[model samples]
Target chain A: MIPAAFEYTRARSLADALKAAGTRGTKVIAGGQSLVPLLRFRLAQPSVVVDIGHLPQLQGIKRAKQGTVIGAATTYRDLLDSKLLHNTHPIIAETTAGIGDRQVRNRGTIGGGLAHADPASDMPAVVLALDAVLTLQSRRGKRSVPARKFFKGPFATAMKKDELLTEILLPFLPQGAGTAYESFEQAASGYALVGVAAVVAVSGGAVTHAAVGITGLADTPFFAASAAKLIGRTPNKEILRAAAAAAVEGVSANEDIHASAEYRLHLARVAVRKALTTAAGRAG
Target chain B: MTQTITLNVNGQALKAQAEPRTLLVHMLRDELNLTGTQVGCDTSQCGACTVLLDGRAVKSCSVLAVQAEGHKITTIEGLARDGTLHPVQQAFWEKHGLQCGFCTPGFVMTTVELLRDNPDPTEDEIRHALEGNVCRCTGYQNIVAAVRSAASALRGSRRPGAAVSGG
Candidate 1:
């Protein structure tokens, strides 16, 4: 199916991209893998397409004093090859690998996936668990939104239409921190039916702190706060299982042709338990 | 307005004027008229449209034609050298890897990427790497065997233009 005819503007820089996006009926598209499909399905019909493919300002993976800052337009393939990010946050690496086939990975951008605000996306939950910050820019100004606040609902984000998600600020993982991502991938679309990102900090062989980020099982990517509070105190199997159950206490997962809401909830519980176990084991 | 994008396909630089949203599969099939790159699934699920973009295999359908501009792309047609079959092709032929020949291009492109990533992949590694590239015929047993054979043949032969990699 052909995408509806629209004016195309290629942005060479982030500022230009946001400026173009400020125009009426314009949409910013990077790594068209996700947005193009929506266009083909008539789910999104923007009058003008702002291409960030040429945006030099929105590219690269670098180890910085703050953390590993990832340009929103960087492709998944680049993320997979990022040595710094691999050493720092393997959860991002692990979660990105679960996304679709090689073609999808080669073309899909992590920033696009998050900004698209797909509740089923694996990155948002993991990024939230990592405490990654998103930089959003518009003609008005720039603001940094913590991952928790960035995602508002399923297929919904707090991003203004004219704003550009230019960078992802992933803090350097501290030593003794263990992170793991577990997901039950939906076969057809290759998104998570439910994804859990667990970050556990261990002190002297005991649980010091834990951040439980659950995605694809709720309207928004969120910290399983109730579950985290309980699971953070102890890392035993019984507690882990109970925390997994609590993570889904009120989660209303999105249901489609692939799986039912009940099935997704079950997977979310299983995934959380598995993720927590992996995280605890890997904790330094 | 259309943009002029350059692509190196089968060792020829083909410049095509295309819409910003044009899929890479269209430039190859319509402009270059090199129909080897098949568009099996436009949504990036089916690997039928896989091609090498800057030495990496990617779904041509999922990317805009403009995205590939100024990059080296290798289509399935460029697999052979001096009119001889590439090792993977030879292995597939010897091992009877094709049933309908629809998914062969994707498999070939994936194998190219696999060998580039891991030259000596274990059978299980081969299985994991090729799992994304599906085959309807032979139940993939013969295809797996073909890849195994191709990996061995290409490893020792340091042919001028050939590189050993993938499952």
Candidate 2:
């Protein structure tokens, strides 16, 4: 089947993209890995397709004094290959490696993936775990949204119709902090059935702080606030198990053909435990 | 909104008129007649339409023809030169890597990108790299062996230059 006909325009600059995006029915194409499949299914039918894959402003990864800035158009493959990300945040690489196979990673952009907000996507959970901030741009100007606040629901976000996600700002972890992501992937599709991303900071052999993000068990990926309360506690097996149990306390686990709501919660607990254990082991 | 777009496919610059929504796979199979790239699953999950865009492997079904303008694309047809098959292709042939060959082109093209990046890969690496591609006929043991064989063959031989020729 073919997608419905649409007009295509490649934006030369951020300004050009903003202007083109002002149209009501314009759909921005960054990597098109997600959007194209939607188009093919006619799940998305826009009057125009604005191509921003070539925009210079939306490319590259850089380290700033405050944090690491990753351009919106940076592909998962690029993130996997980034030496800076590997050294500073190997969790991003570990998470991306478990994303769809090489072909999808080659074309799926971090910004596009997050903006698409697939409930099962790996980036949102990892970014949420890292406490990353998302920058959005429009003709009017730019604004920042914390990763936790950006996602509203499955395949939904807080992005305005005319806005584009410009960059992701991830603060550097404190020295000796360790981060890890674990997911149970659906065999054929590779979508996470239940996944967890954890960032743990240990000091004097106890957990100083921990950030846990949970996905595939709810309508949206969310930071596990209950799990974060593990701060300043010793991450012994018993305590970590208790924290993992609390990780899904507030989540209304999604029920689908893949897994029942009860089973998903079970997987969530298991994933959280593994993620936190691995993260704590790596932490100082 | 049909427009003339030029594609540098398999080393030849060619122009075709298509709508903005035209997928790269359709343009390759229908317009350019480069049908080696299959569409096993129209969705992007099956890597049947995998191809190299500017030297990176991507599912062509998920890329619009207009979006691929001015980029180098290498399909399975682009793998051979002077009657000699690329090392990856030869390994697949020698190892009996394929059955019901619908998915072979995608595997071959994907392996091209894999070996280009990591010429020497372990068995686990090869299996992991094949995450996007699915071969229903073979249980993937032979396919894994083929990739290992190809990696060794390429590492030992002069890497095939991605030369575009008129087909």
Scored by DockQ, the top model is 2
Q: Please state the error at residue B101 of candidate 1 in Å.
A: 0.3
For candidate 1, write residues A8-41 as lDDT tens digits: 7677766778788788888888888788778766
Q: Which pairs clash in model 1? A: B114-B165, B114-B166, B115-B165, B115-B166, B116-B165
Q: Against the true chain A, what TM-score does chain A of candidate 2 give?
A: 0.98
- Give each model's whole-structure lDDT: 0.81, 0.89
Q: How accurate locally is residue B64 in candidate 1, as Cα lDDT from 0 to 100?
A: 69
Docking class of 1: medium
lDDT (10s digit) by residue, model 2, range A153-253: 98989998888899999999977888899999888788999989999999998788899998888999989988768888998999999999998886799
TM-score of each: 0.93, 0.97
DockQ each candidate and list the results.
Answer: 0.51, 0.86
lDDT of 1 by residue, B56-104 (tens): 8877876667777778888888888777888888888899988998999
Q: What is the lDDT of residue A240 in candidate 2?
A: 92
Which 10 consecutive residues of model 1 chain A have the lowest summed lDDT? Answer: A225-234
Q: Which predicted model would earn the best TM-score?
A: 2
The whole-model C-alpha lDDT of candidate 2 against the native structure comes to 0.89
C-alpha lDDT of residue A62 in model 1: 84
